[model samples]
Target chain A: MAVHQRQTVPQAADRLMPSGAAHHEQVVARQRRGRIWAIVFQAAMLAGIVALCALLLNILNQSFGYVAIVNTIDPAELAVDGVPLNELPKENLVEILEANISAGLMRRYEHDIPFAERSRENVHDLILERVVEPQVQATWGLFDSIFARDSVFAEADERFPGSDVYFRSWLTTSFISKSQSSEPLRAGVRTAIFGSLWVVAITILFSFPIGVGAAIYLEEYAHKERLLNRLIQTNINNLAGVPSIIYGMLGLAIFVRILELFTSGAFLGIGDQSTANGRTIISAGLTLGLLILPLIIINGQEAIRAVPNSLRQAGFGLGATHWQVIWHHVLPSAMPGVLTGTILAVSRAIGETAPLVVVGASTFIALDPSGPFSKFTVLPIQIYQWTSRPQDEFRNLAAAAILVLLILLLSLNASAVLLRNRFDRSRAIA
Target chain B: MSRSAPIAQAAISAESMQGPVAGAESTSESVLGGGPPLDLSRKPRVAESLIQGFLFLCGAISILTTLGIVYVLGRESLLFFANEEVNLLKFFGGTEWQPAIGRFGIWPLVTATFMASLIAMAVALPMGLCIAIYLSEYAPQRTRSVLKPILEVLAGIPTVVYGYFALTFMTPLLRGIFGRDIVEIYNTASAGIVIGILVIPLVSSMSEDALSAVPNALRQASYGLGATRLETAVRIVLPAALSGVAAAFIVAISRAIGETMIVAIAAGAGPNFTFSPFRAAETMTGHIVRISGGDLSYDSIDYNSIFAIGLLLFLLTLSLNVLSQWIVRRFREEYE
Candidate 1:
């Protein structure tokens, strides 16, 4: 042992002497590489965040610029009143454009002469300067106002009358307005907005009760040994990961044709069998509901699972019935989670265009859907339709519509967070 | 120490023996409260059975949802095959997807879907793992508390916003850098990259949980062995949490596959069977949207193709999800 210790001490002495200089250099080189890599990794992370922010800033800057610059064109200066609306004077152009948009020319540009043949600047230019620009300006202000509106936009509008304004409030009014011609400058997403509302309402109605009930049963009632229950728990988790487009396919098969329940049959015994709205709003809603069900169930289960077991035990010990224990004890404790889950699920449902599009939710209805079986169009589909057009105006409208949808989504999430905070505090107190 | 220690040990042993018996006695006492409190020999048969039944029913609902999924997918897929004569091998193996030519081969859509998912994983894995490392090892408690919630908010942003960002910003930026024709207005790269961004939160959050699950003692031992904090984390803690990290990756991949809006809005709808990520290509979901958009008859081959694609997608995602769950369950760390 003493000899081995003497050898180890010699090895240490070698490091202290010049003999181990190469080893020390090698160790230093390795440490330098490691430090360099760590620095690189940190820089890369910072770069990612910066890149994301830059992308967001770029979109905001470009779209706002488009709104500002494009709106500056005075349609009154390009007067050709003997001809189409785009040829009229800027002051007359605004009046004509508003009248045309109100007359549904904005939504159905194909019927207008400008759509048939691209006139000078197309009909979209006049529509842009008059209808869409003003509309986006108004809605943009409304959105800013929702989050404590500063005077910057109001000041900009006041400073630049009939010129480019700061927060174009036109998006709000444009969003509420109906669809327009391929001219994005004039197009709006009103039809899509109404369609999204209907679809979301139906999705929530279908998924909420079922999801919460399933969670309640799983957390508060299910026996540990039940194989069937175990199988379900497993499948729900799996289902949560299933691709959403698969749901669209399911909707197509189950809701559109085979079911033949809502509008698959001959509509009013007049339209050809091939020309019916087989894909109705009901099918779209059901498909979306199923798509988001697993999300709701998983979230609901987590929340329910988070509830202390002692609460249930306490309820049972207090002579509460089994249903009472679940209803009064377990359900209330998990309400915040359920609420957040519901909000998230609804947000997903509202934004889903693929599944609904597959289910034939793309029918361009002029008016709002009056019933579950009515033909519907949602915001994404509307944006898609507008953006797909060759005209540049449609692109602007798509941006404005996107802003509106973003606002709705943000508000919904904000409310959910608020609700969660309130419930969290209450639960802590209890 | 001598008196209290033995007494505490004796109390614990005695309580273990008596705990269950006492629990049962209390339960009986609640039900048979009108009788003697000491003579708790009765069982609350009705109460116990009722509770058991309620739980069984809950289990049954879950069973029902699963059955419903299988039933729905099975019935439609069966109907699809009953009406069409698609050679399964050719559908997957064929290099083209031209419906006008009567070729129902789906290789293009499958390729798009897989390529996009691969790109997403490629971007998300390293980035997510690194962020997990920062969160679990480096970040202070207050910083972690702040950053985690912000990351979650990023996840909660509606996919439509991501889609818009891809179309309006990412595509334009890429085009400017690479030249106009280098990237189409609607290309797979933008969607794939943005989808990666969408799934980052999922990957990082799950991986952090996994890393946290690794015992601190293991980390301390590695440090005691003269390893740096970074080395200990990368070598010891990460290895211990390898299974969990893998599961998180799989789940993130699954999420990328299922995502629709970003792809639908940003990815081009042209269904060309090409492997070029920069090209405008169609996905299985994208094709479903395109075909459904067109005015096709209910019984047309094009209509039936939707279900076929859906069935294939379902099978692919279902397996990934199941595998993820299996990995999570098999390697989950348990604490005393």
Candidate 2:
């Protein structure tokens, strides 16, 4: 009745026509404005994509291309009476190494690895290193190598005449398998990869169980109003935000300085105790473990929070203990989520350089991290070292390492996302 | 008999003195504590008690970590100041940070840190807000899903890789734009810009959460009033999540300030007190990494000074975190 009366009123008709026309115009204007802002917002979103793309593209650009490989002594010259240097037996190769280099150096090599014990291929490698030193004199990126091929060759000729302008993928099979070398062409991330694995393994071992335990306490056991519980909760939150370098300093003081014997394995009468000053894989891993502990606990709590109360109720209804309910029902349901969180944490720990730097990760560690007590250089630290050098070739090596690091991080993260999605799907089904 | 309840309270049944179990873990869909409490006299499981104690101990490690950081930074910083070559006032007041010359003025490093972070925030804040708004309001579900992992990838890229990007790509690009001579080979601009890029994911993700939490009613009401989505986003949803957005901004700034590798690599060598982003400067993190990367004796002033800087960095980040928390608690808009 009120609607009919208002519609019948003459004053309403006067108000409606003018306002309707004006409102239509205003709506058009507003919609236009909205469209513009939406584009602006979208552009901002694309900026991240653009930045990420540029970063990756830049890395890829430098990771491969033509290199001017200049040999210190031409391989043809090393051929002795129709026998190539590489074709020579281990003894002949050792002879070549001995004849070309200093006797002192030859003796050092002998002391390091006796020629009789060394494989033929290894001796050939030694011959190449000591004699036929193929060095990268100048390089062109993948972009220039492909699009501007003529220019690259011309520039190589002008800048490094007589050097072989070979198309070389910096990330070759040998790069993955070989150890670190001063020569950019020979330097590989094998040792760094081993170090990264050891550090990450130690990180997971230290963090996962303790993180889950902390989450279980906070979620399933602790009193909400209790002071200690609140403190712990707040402390975890704060710790999550604490600058990672602070953790580095803590590790330096406590693990490196204060507890040197333990980390160095001196207390256990293992490792090289005399040379070990506690800057080892153990310290780096512990630092990172502390760095990511809060992350794990927080995400673990998130996972636990996702579990349905009915499941717990069902368990308790069957006269099961609280721990049994948690173990059988809550924990199983939360496992995927917890694992996802852990993988993400592990990825972060893997990429982290600053904390490990403070804990004294050797950038030039040649040997693989044999044990927790051994000196280590993770992939990121290796990249940092290479990139910091004021040489374009080292930058190329750094880009290759970046590619490797990104692949590792991406695989780990993709698994995390997959786990989360699977969990979500299961929840949706249940 | 309620010990271990509050550290010292030893209760066989830990929940005996407490009221009906109201688990905070329960989701909104299921209100827990509907079941009656367990019998108080029931036999306690030993594994349950032991596990609870173990979990409690695990929880305490975070506290221990915090204490460890504080103690180390504090003790070392004190040692730094105790040195005859260094004093508290000169450390802060001195403009030249060359420790070899006994001039410990931290102003250059602090100012450099501030300027770099300032540039970072300048780039990140507006861009991050836009990203948050875009994701929250305008993006299709598929777009959001695809972008989620992509953003994670962006965020997960190591700082060292970013340093490489800054030094190799960003620096050359900047030099091309601003002329090679004006922009130093290692300049703050590239590092700051890259750091800002690093932080965008953080700010956007946090702000997106805040925006997602705002009730749909506000957006619907604005639309009913003939407001466009853009107006609704700016005038209604943003205001509603303003506290959260503010928190995100502060957190982003703190992160940028604490960033090490990019600044260390691209921000150049030496502690240069300069206002120009195109010039080289060293941040506290950069200085720390450079100084400590070399072998310095344990008790030397140089070694101790990095600790002092670490203390400053630690305090600055901690306070920002606490402040962000306070802001969220104090001003969060409660929706029914």
Candidate 3:
């Protein structure tokens, strides 16, 4: 019995030792594999952050750089009575514009905004664009401008002997205030900004009320069991996924063609009959309104649905009608969420170029939109047009425009976030 | 509560007393004298009906918009097909695309669109999956919150800006990597890369939702079987969330197909039927924009062609979106 026990104990020991060791090794190997995968995942996240940084860096590099400006007619030469062109009187600047450009162009400009009523600053800009006609002979990106300043200057001097080399930010205050020009130095985004504002304003006017109303009906009034209601709900969900360019096509077919009279202001007798057609701000707005309508409706429904059922029940107990309960309690509580959605939708609308392009936003228009009926150019189209140009300076201008657009979009989103946060905090306290 | 109850009762009594006087003053004197007291509540009911009607009208507009889109696309596409100058057989089967000289072949645009979309998917799918896996399985709450919004910011940046980035930055980088001769100035590769970057947020967000929706018990079971985190994530979690991942991929592909500004600005204007990503090519959306942006006269064949292209694009994206929705609905895992 003692000999049998001894042999069994040794055999048990031998079995346990190898198996335990193998288990330990397997766990270690798995841990190593896990660590590797964790690194890979982290690397992917890092790539996203890096890509974002690169995009911003690239835009910044293009927006501000060393530019060699060589005017066709020197500002000093154009100075009248010892007054430099930069400091020239409004009258002198106007005279220069009238003298240089064609009579037809001058007449059109005057007719569009009236030269007599023009601001002094406006006349100054006109002189810079039409008279001086400053051309960028060479440009260096932000990196080269700073690190290789001497080399850039040398190259500029070698290429454009008389040109003045300066580090310029294309996004000056004047950039937003001045009008577009063939000359990159004179090009600005004033008309485009105004057009964008007009389109966005109209988009909001059309979309917000309709979107919210649809949400109210779908969430509070429509019975889920009803086939019609289910169909409407399904349609809304699908509409949200429809490509934006399709909306542009719809705008082209309907607003630009079928509804031309109303959109072109011919019916209202308000627009320039000759140049103005259905491709106007109103059409673009309505198209974008359609583009974002589904987004707003879906978001609005979500916000309304998020309102607790207890609140509705309590209102009913107080003898409040269904409509009254929704109007008074549901809407108020859902407002922050609704506004958040609207802000997102508006941001999307502002950044949208596809639908607007399809809706026939002008690629270049110096004149600001007079009203909804006027032909318009938005910021995206302006940037697109500039980027398509061959000159390096136009790319710089496009970069600057991108910065403006980003800032505008980010601020709008940030404000919405802040507002939502405040609302959430207030609600939590209550 | 007791103290406020008496005040509420008094206010109600006062309101009831004043209600009759207000009603009598507001209503016609003859009706007030002879007929039963006016049903004041009926006024609110009438307003309620009016409001309901308006809201219902608003709801109907969305459905109308869908109908409008279908009608417009169909009507114009029919016009395009009816024109004798545009041959339907050549449009479907031919490789060449020269609209100016009267060749209306569409294969070039379709091929370019497919090439760019394929390139975009190649970059976006794996990276997006990695991001989703990390966010769902690895990231702490704080990191997720910080990272998610930043990714959304990437989504929010204007597509025109991405176009510019592709033109100036991505193209130059590609030229540096593959000798200048290989990569054209307006190659599809750069645009495809930028587009991939643009869609990363979309793919990652959708996939993360899918991964997060996976039941924790499956993960726990895998762990109980002595599986590592990587093994569990790849073998168990990913398989369980396969439909969701596929849906995200399909949706991203649709978005890439419909994307306009990037391709319009960065991809070359000419429609080349080449399968090479490094060459200049135009997509269907790009072709539509380029033609429509020009001064094409009404009733001209060129004008009609854009609508035809638009119709094709619409069908492609619509089918993809519907498929994605169907997949999500059909295969979604519901864990109690």
Candidate 4:
């Protein structure tokens, strides 16, 4: 054994030592390749960061810039009692709307939503949308607007005679307060915001309790060896990966068609009978709820499973029932985690567009969503419609809307991260 | 250890064992004064049964939802087939997709969908692998925490916004590179590129999880053998995580296939069976949106056609998901 070890030691030493300059060069070449690859990996990561920054910068660039707007009916022609149109009173704006729009359109507007009950600001918005119909003739990017302001104004004047050039930030307080319009200058995301809020609320209400319950049943109650339990578990994992648009088709067929009476608010007896249909907030909400259900259930299951089994055993050893132990001991510990999951699910619901589009989200709706039964659109759909328009101004509006969506999503995710950290701290302490 | 002291002490006490029942009895006696204590045990039985039933029902809802999806899609697809004009052979084999003129050929849409997915994969796969390798092997913990969240922010950005970015920025950039005549205003290349960007975070996050799951011993052994970090990552870690990386690829492809807004807004609303990425084309999701967005009569052929397309899409994505889940399960079993 000593002789064998001596021979092996010499052979190992020989293998470790480089035999010549050629071997040393080969090792150096390999090391250089490794360094190149490391640099490539770092560059790939930087590319991801660059892509994100470019997206945000591009959207922001379009959201605020110099725009050349030409009004269809010159504001000078609509002066009341020698007051310029821009400086006129609210009542005069209402008068201008009534005078300019067709009688049929005026009647339809009143029928859809009473003109008299509408606030002065609403009337002003209507006048701006229908009467003036300001069309964007030219747009310059933010860089051009800032660095070449004089050149931009000069170009606008040369291209669009008698047009007004203004640096407009499409995202404003009014942009969040007013409803949609055919004219980009007057359009706002108020209705879409409300629609998104209502839909997300319903999604939470429907998915949360059920998701938590499902998680509890799966994690604490169901026997792991049972086939039914295994099937249910597998089904859920598969569902989490299903493309969201399929859920929309399900909504269209079931919520919008088979159960139209309920979704259209006919059963509730509250929606507008003339215009109300199954393409309402309820269908969209339910569809989104379905889309996020698997996500919530899966996340909740993970949270519940993470709770220490010893806690449950302690409750059971104290003569507590299974349900009692779960309620008092397991749920409290899992609450923060469950809430984080819910927040994430809701964020996903808020950003989802494909399913809502399939569920027949309206492209243009001025009326606010009064209830679950009302026809509605959401922020993503609004952004989509605006982006598709031929006008450059609508693209600006799309960018502004995108900013609002990004803020909403980031805030929700940030809260989720905070909640998760809190959970982690509590767990560490325990 | 100190925080668990009280709980551990409570577990050893006899009073704690009878804690719930005794407390309930005392509270009941005080409230009723002269009356007998309430049957706390019996009371919880009824409530326990009800809660258990409720939880079971909630679990059933997921199953019910799956059933509902299947039933609804099946019903509508059957109705679509019941129409005399929809020939099964022609629907699958035909190359043209002019549904407006009563041509129900689906291959054109399928080709467009696959073409876009392929382009998206070409951009996403390598970038995602490199990012994953960097995050798992090279990046420090602090950098990982910061960069991972930032990458997720890219994932969370709504697809519609990506659509706008593609149409406004990427398309113009591509136009400048490829010239106006070659790059159509609404070409698949721009949409596919943005979709790839959207998918990068998904792929990177998933592949990083896979790469990090590789045992540290493997990496250390390679290092001990005089292997460089990059060589160890590329030669040893990647091979071990191959199944997981493949699963990520499949899932990302499924996502790309189902992506709607980017294609709908940027890839023009025309189904064309072409090999060129520079041409404007319509994908399956795009076609569904276009038809559904328009005003069609309730029972019209166009309405039924969308259901058929949805069924096809559903099946495709479902199979992909199932395959990915299978691969993941197999990988987990092999590793753990």
DockQ of each: 0.30, 0.41, 0.38, 0.43
For candidate 4 chain A, which ten residues in a row score worst on lDDT?
A1-10
Candidate 4, A1-430: lDDT as tens digits: 0222323345457675644557666777887898899999999999999999999999989988999989898878889889987787777887788889999999998998898788777777677778888888888788789989999988888889999899888889989887887767767999999999999988888989999999998887787778988988988987887778889889988999889999999997888799767999989999998889888999999888888767866785555776788899999999998999989889999999989988999878898889888899999999988888887888889999999999989889999999999878877897
DockQ, Cα level, model 2: 0.41
For B1-336, candidate 2 gives per-residue lDDT tens digits of 222122212112334412223332223332234454334334556777888889889999998988888889999999999899888889878999988889999999999999889989989999999999999999999999998778878888888999999999999999999999999999888899999999999999999999999999999998886567899999999999999999999899889989999998999989998899999999999998888788868988888999999999988988998999999999999999
Candidate whose TM-score is highest:
2
TM-score of chain B of each: 0.83, 0.87, 0.86, 0.87
DockQ agreement of candidate 4 with the native complex: 0.43
Q: Model 3: which residue pairs collide?
A: none
- Between prediction 1 and prediction 3, the one with superior lDDT is 3
Ranking of all candidate structures by their lDDT, best first:
2, 3, 4, 1
Candidate 3 structure quality by residue, lDDT tens digits, A337-426:
999999999999999998888889887788989999999999999998899989898999999999999999999999989988998898
lDDT of 2 by residue, A140-243 (tens): 88989899999998998998889999888888889989899898878999999999999999999999999999999899988889998999999999898887
CA lDDT, candidate 4, residue A264: 94
Candidate 4 residues lying further than 4 Å off, grouped into runs, are: A1-12, A71-134, B1-44, B331-336
Off by over 4 Å in 1: A1-31, A66-170, A177-183, A262-278, B1-85, B333-336
Q: Can you write out model 1's per-residue Cα lDDT over B128-203, one digit (the tens) per residue?
A: 8888877887778987887777677677666766777788777887799888878888888888988888888889
User: Distance from true position, residue A62, model 4, in Å?
Assistant: 0.8
